[model samples]
Target: MHNAINESYLGERYSEWSLDSDSTIETPNKNQAPWGLENISPIFRAYENSIWQNHVAAMWSHLEARYNITSNDSCGTHVHISLIEGYSLSALKRICQSIIYFEPAFEAILPRARLGNEYARSNWLDNPNFGYKRLSRRESMVVIEKCTSVRELVLLTPTTISSLGGISSISLKPLKEPLNFVVVQQARLSAMSLYKISKIPATVGGLKWFIEAAQLPQQPGLFDTRYINLLLDSVGPKLTREPKPMGKLSPDKLRKLQTKKDEDKRKNVMLAKISQPPYWG
Candidate 1:
């Protein structure tokens, strides 16, 4: 699989350069991928639109031509938006808030199988049975609004534990707060430095523009799939519970948390000195 994928592209495979096997292509669930034949997933590095069309798209075409590639209801694509340039603290906050705010509308278009799938669960809906509180637009915004750093912003996303045994398999268990504390702690330890970036385009136009861009016509009522809300109990949290702050750190304390490299500099410097031969003096 790796050789076939490498033959289709020019750059080094990520596995060729990195020790993190998790970042490389992974095999899809046997239940989901096409049956009767072995499945091979060739993950590609992030690329701009043109490069995506020329390289990634071309690779898929090559695979389809060489092998009788097929898809089914169980199969789905995961599109990861790259953070190569990263985002401003405020922009990151808005994106998170926006996702939570517009999630229902986003779910409206998805196929029936994706509606409440455990693998990609809804972030806004709180299923008491599953144990979590749903956040309102204002409540969600307040949570995001309080974010003072990248680490705090990231913690707001769904937390997951890897499926047993390996990266090649696509299995994960979503963890809620308290249970997710260890993962949260590790994230803080590896937090990236918060640096200012270019201005983020205004998201004020909101979902209106999005629907228009999607060419979906404005309608009198919500998409007829309103049944999903009742069936999945995805309308909102039926039981009232307070929205928890994504992080406990006060503004002052958050400011004190340093990037991993900055936190380790003194030890690194000492190690560098110790590795050197002692002065002849």
Candidate 2:
């Protein structure tokens, strides 16, 4: 496959291929080539397995077309192509897997800044502190109390608090609307740890707030259950409610809930299916 690609794109400029173990090619001026061409190892064969080979081929074709360069010997001397040596197939596969995983996270987190929410927009501004500098501890708590919805609260979180060092306090109140419980917890933590170490607080409470909030779960898990557990372990013994049997939904209630969910899904599908295309006529 590599030979075929070389023949198609490299042709006469493709000099005699030298298979090597741990060799570095030097440019005429003795400086390393910008592409690190010297490092092209023989083990790259496993690295350039089918999918990666296809990607490289596509890239080559694109450059060829864009530059209007032919595979024929446009220049007289042979062009030296270097391949890196000594990587196992497993290593290459891991690299590809990492790219697959990272691409989605990047897509998810990158465009969040563009969301229309005022808090989201403000937090995304290109300031040295990433917008957390705008609020003090007291002001942050005030903002959290003022947030009426989960989305607003989530957006406000990163901006309001600095970090979660440890658990300070936990409280739960019954909610009447979309959710059954409103759990408010306070923690003392650092901004850097909240932003970089923990994913739950970063996503659920917001990175800045997570950093300053002293209370948090020692064990890693989803925010709802983890926070509840932390509260139960630290502050639960203080509460008076007798533990009730976990409530069970009646069949009729379950059916009604499922019906509503199906309707929501159908509406979303229809919305997504509708498309606007240019019509010259």
Candidate 3:
């Protein structure tokens, strides 16, 4: 199948979506409110819009109850983008190389506090000077996977990652979601794991997949249940849930402000170190 880049699609590194309990919004939108995952501590799912949407709130509430989520389950958003015919493996490699070429820009922007600790600290690389480059390696992992006879690139990791890390975390497969690393609930984790797998019937929404194997054993009333196992549901997109772009800051303005903030922080830290005395007086 021929695939091309949808100009509308954005390649951006967005901020961590804040989860507010007393959110007055009624619906979920793309920018005013975008959905994100935060299963770790303070386990609560917040709405992404000024108004709450039908499916999102109810669905997340159901999940929260069934899964005993805790603070430890917290995870940073690791977006995965599928590379189709237009964006083949070779294209991804070029992107990776570009990031490596502009490694300083990445290091200049990403705060040090976000790196080197434990949870998400440090890229696959450990050194601050070069470790930042690892961030670009994540996207390099995107590769083509064939399910049945269909073939496509399954992108589950960032366009950049550490040198050692492979496809970031989730184990990509044709029939199922990547192997889940976030343990929302130990006992119920097995069931939650199915959410990411393409084999299960998609429930919530976003983009999803459905199998049409005419050859699979069909159970027409009299026959037993064989196709039931094949039923799978993945998340798909909902226009109603997205926020309108009526009121928003310009992207260029936002980038400039964010850059200044980050740069100022780095500058202050450097000056402080130079002025402060050594521990051994």
Candidate 4:
């Protein structure tokens, strides 16, 4: 599968390289990706929102070192946003409404065929469940609790992800704090659209795993350092929860911060002194 991808279509690999996988899917309860070697298809699968965008960037560093990126029907991103507790399907519906409302911007960036594939069929998206009719929090939860799995998420068209697993996945937003899941999902949809880079031509010798990746255009610079950093900086905040600021430090605490910086500098200098020269250069 890897060798079959066209280098011409995907672009070129332009950086130092090594194979190190950092991609993480913290969403809990996702049908455990076939773990045994039998079902184990060699493919890079990552699920990260804005909070952990840096992990995505870091993972890119490893991939760009090897293959170009290909964004096609088979290789698209599915955003799994965690919902706040006591949330209603209405919240999710509003998000669907927004996606349908602002379809043009997203349409321009996504591959034409992706909108109709099994994973993201446009016809299925036209369901009445995700319509403007608001489901009460109780009503929504009832439907949600009865199901489990991304497949069941089909009912919530445009917003394809149903529910996932994690404390980060499990931790619900504070009840009283007003949060707009629509805004969050809309933001995620926009980010996904931007990242849906469609084609690349490339060549390689061997192929194994994720046959679908070979079906369309490839992304050569998918792991470009500059591109990765830019992507993370742009959307990292939106995806992750903001950490509360440890209130202002006392004079003693300020001194400790200074001490910490000094310790870090000393350790870094020592490490550099012991390090070997660059291998690739």
Candidate 5:
């Protein structure tokens, strides 16, 4: 059951990348390169939001083709490479790394919660239900302790943990001070979105593994499926077959571009007004 759950999670991860990549190609003008300064445009309202947008763009660009090539699915969802037989270990590691890098703000919130626990602090500990097996009690405790506060810890822990083994029981102790409800809510929402975006690249990485594992012939499958599709779907029909050499923009064309930019700015301002967060006293 535990393995199955993990597999399901990985599959979802892949699916997210698939969707994100599809969205990017379908919205190329909005799909700026990862870490690109263009993210500061009015379309992305905040730094974190911009980061999430770009991460999704990058991730989708990475994974789309790989999965399409393998064309494998577990259940109804596309079978992410991480869930493919024999691909879990490395896939898990890569997924972890991507989460850390692209979602640092969310990552920053976890260690704060773990510091309040006693059992989590101890050096020597046993999984009592598992017959006293040595556990990474200290390491786990350290991770928790390093968290800045309780809110951070809550954000870090998985939403659910299911045991495939014998009966599992756990206890929770109240924090000295509960996390700020509003802040917690915002952080949770942002973290959830970030997690969603990070899944794209990880899914692509997983698909790459699957292709290799299956000993399929190397070709343009990865780019052809994910990136090209994204570009075609989003950017509309390819306007030209041959690459045109760069040329200076004529004054008339430049003026038209500037006008479009100004219009975009006005539209964004209006949208922002409509979507402004509610205020309360």
Candidate 6:
């Protein structure tokens, strides 16, 4: 299948497709990769396009035309959203609240196969970790609404275990929405944790070390540029770059102005630091 895909019209792009052990998709060929996992799942790398017609739709059409592909109970689609500005805390809280309120409506439209599926378990289900079963509708709203931080929100949400025995705080599977709450919620949790810890320097470089220290799950693909888990990490480096000037200013004048601004900012910071009440030993 690897050779077949690479030699096709879209072969160049097909190079990214690799076999995944987790995939349950049946394949005729039993030829195993060096790792000894079954060569059934030909997973595509994460891709983004401004226009869906040009990229994903075209690829799907090409594959369907050339290959004798058939869908079964195991086959389902997942759509990942990569926000340009990333998600704000208030937005995430509101989203969770909406999902909680309208989950029944969402389940009503989905195929029977998706329901009770281990991959994407409904967050509203009864779990010992979260006692949502006994709560009234208004009480449930209060529970999620009262969550002050990402960590609090995550604690309130339910989690699923992966087939590989890993705790999937964020399940990759979503029926139509394809939304993974755990990934975003966890990322925000880490960011908030970093902010609270005075020992960890408040910078992008400090995040990796802090994650290691905190013993947070460090899945290989989960923290990549494609995932929202690194949204905060990705933005930190970009913030250091100088902004493009919109107003008229000569290069020399701009340099002098920047220097003056920097000095003033430093002075203000120092003054603020000194203004803090002295701690009693």
- Hey, what RMSD does candidate 1 come out at? 16.9
Q: Which ranges in model 5 have alpha carbons more than 4 Å from their true place?
A: 1-83, 88-90, 104-218, 223-281
Instruction: Assess candidate 6 and give its TM-score to the true structure.
Output: 0.43
Clashing pairs in 1: none
| Rank list by lDDT | 6, 1, 4, 3, 2, 5
> Between 3 and 6, whose TM-score is larger?
6
TM-score, every prediction: 0.44, 0.16, 0.23, 0.30, 0.17, 0.43
Q: Which digits, one per residue and each the tens of the lDDT, describe model 1 over residues 1-281? A: 34321122233333221111111122365345333222222333322221222333444555668876544344443322223355667655545554444444445434555444433444544322112554555565576567688776665543311111011112222111001111112222233222211121113222333323333222212222122223223323322222222224456434433432243342222233233332211
Candidate 6 local lDDT, 1-281, one digit each (tens): 34222122222322222322323333445465322121221222222222222333444465568855444454444433334356665666555543433344334333455444443454444333333366643356567667788776666664422121112222233222212233433443444321144454424444334344444453433432223333334344212211111224468556654664454343322233223332211
lDDT of 2 by residue, 111-226 (tens): 22222221112222211232235543233334434555555444444322211100111111211111101122212211222123334322322322332353433322112333
lDDT of 4: 0.29
Model 3 CA deviation exceeding 4 Å by range: 1-59, 65-68, 72-74, 86-90, 101-114, 117-281
User: Pick by lDDT: which candidate is best?
Assistant: 6
Best by TM-score: 1
Q: Where does candidate 1 stray beyond 4 Å?
A: 1-12, 15-49, 126-131, 159-208, 211-281
Model 2 misplacement above 4 A: 1-57, 65-133, 136-150, 153-281
RMSD of 4: 22.0
Q: Report, for every candidate in turn, its global Cα lDDT versus the true structure.
A: 0.34, 0.26, 0.27, 0.29, 0.26, 0.38
Can you give the lDDT of residue 21 in candidate 2? 17
